[model samples]
Target: MRIGQPGRPLDARKDELILQAGRELLLRGGPLALTMEAVARASGVSKATLYRRWPHREALLEALVLREAQPLLSMLEGTPTDDAGLAAKLEAFLDSMLALMGQPGYRAYLQAIVALPQQQADLQRIWWLGPHQTMESVAALLRRYAAAQGRRWPAAARDAETLIGMAIGLEQARILYRQRPWRADARLRRRLIRAVVASFLGRRSAGIAVCEGNVGRG
Candidate 1:
């Protein structure tokens, strides 16, 4: 829906189609191929309609980012709390996130975002709304699941954030420095899922736990 921040209401259906077209073009040929005319052609919408809504390339890209984040948000809408159910849900999330982040489409999206002109408001929103919002959603889910299992969130919150950071960093390295394929092996994913549970349970099982003065940063 068109939740206009400060402007007149825009057509939600048209906005959705434009964003879908932009993402398709971006994933297919990277950022260079994303043009207003191409998107209009792909979406069967007029160029005037898109310009009236977006008015610029950067706005269109930001809209696409919101579109991309929608599916991720939906994935966390309903999560289970039981051990087995939670583990399954977490594994699914991790695997899906890994695959999505590792894809060429995602890499292209990141590249486009980084290359955008350095405007203060846009950069701030990119940081706060984009990545920070996504991280907060994940943290909330972890906190909820932990509480449901009769555990304190703050007790394991640090490790949980650190683990998420590790996963994100590993994926970033694969995209930036290393060209190696991301291996989401079943055994490794299962290990990560168990490690998350064990950390919350305060078990010092067979895993790396760097204790930083009473705080375990995994």
Candidate 2:
């Protein structure tokens, strides 16, 4: 709850409350519904207090977006030492990401941010700091995980992005158009996971050192 003003000091307790209120407003109602006056009322802060910290809606929105995206950085933990481990980790990561995407709050927040005018600096900051950073971190994790297994990282990284994108893309589509659940059957899930892994291995791009000992493509 730093709000936009670094120089102006506020009590930590009040700041936390204001941030909490702002987050609730943004998540539950989307950006259009987020207003400084509304947040002040929600948080029981005076309008003067709200304005003193977050001067505009964009500033508050950006802060919340940053907070939301920060946790995604840790999604790469506990990657398996072998190919099975890697595939499992990838599946888990995709599942977690899809879950996030499917949340109503997340969907609304992303839609609001993306629809903002291109020249809006705060929105640009949100995009760069949040989803863009998550994508970069995911790509980096894929590269490193493959390398740890004595495999080439780039091809696998590419495939990882592709797979992750497919999952997210499909989920987003459902959110936008059909409002349908992204309910993948066992066969479909297996097919997607294997297809991505197969593409990487088939290309010999992962630089896997143990070709003879590990799982083979179908």
Candidate 3:
């Protein structure tokens, strides 16, 4: 008989154990240490069961990130009725992302992935795919915010990417590269969020002005 029977209900407890084991292994020893054997041993689950849930290591890692991203994703899924509401939600999302990046284990994992040899397609693939959906959701939020003001921001999706990239870059520069004490005080977080929002709005206004000038010339 199959280890997990066809009709048998899956155990939530076992799934949590497996995920928890995977997370601990990842945080403790990077991706290289998170082999199927290690996870199975750590979680005290049979290899067959682990394989039954996650076919490969990448799949398991992706699941872990997705789980971690749920709260931020939930906020993105919300509807913000006004400029203030959108700005508040965006700030919350950025704060959440910064918090995730601030985690030593998570930061190490991202840095390790980035430092991998160019020949490793997995690194590039993960980097692109890991945050693609969340960025899209963010773009949707930005678009909604602009629409509410009766102004269309061209390249909302690109702007979303830029906002996230800026946050990550700031964290890397201050906390990771400089090895400075990471102080995510409320004031700093607010400043970062404001910078991103202001930059986007500035570019958006400039674009509108340029278009208007061209229309006048025509």
Name the regions of candidate 1 deviating beyond 4 angstroms. 1-16, 25-38, 51-62, 149-151, 155-157, 184-218
> CA lDDT of each candidate?
0.64, 0.67, 0.74
Using TM-score as the measure, the top candidate is 3
Which candidate should be chosen as best, given lDDT against the real structure? 3
What candidate 3 gets wrong by more than 4 Å, as runs, is: 1-10, 148-151, 165-169, 181-183, 191-218
lDDT ranking from best candidate downward: 3, 2, 1
Instruction: Kindly give the number of clashing pairs for every candidate.
Output: 0, 5, 0
lDDT of candidate 3 over 27-60, digit per residue (tens): 6666666788999999899999899889997888
**Candidate 1 structure quality by residue, lDDT tens digits, 78-150:** 6466656655555556566666766756666667656766564556655665566666776777667766756
Q: Flag regions of model 2 displaced more than 4 Å.
A: 1-16, 32-35, 46-60, 77-80, 155-157, 184-218
Which stretch of 10 consecutive residues in model 3 shows the poorest summed lDDT? 1-10
Better of 1 and 2 by lDDT: 2
- Per-model TM-score, in order, reads 0.64, 0.66, 0.77
Candidate 2 backbone overlaps, count: 5
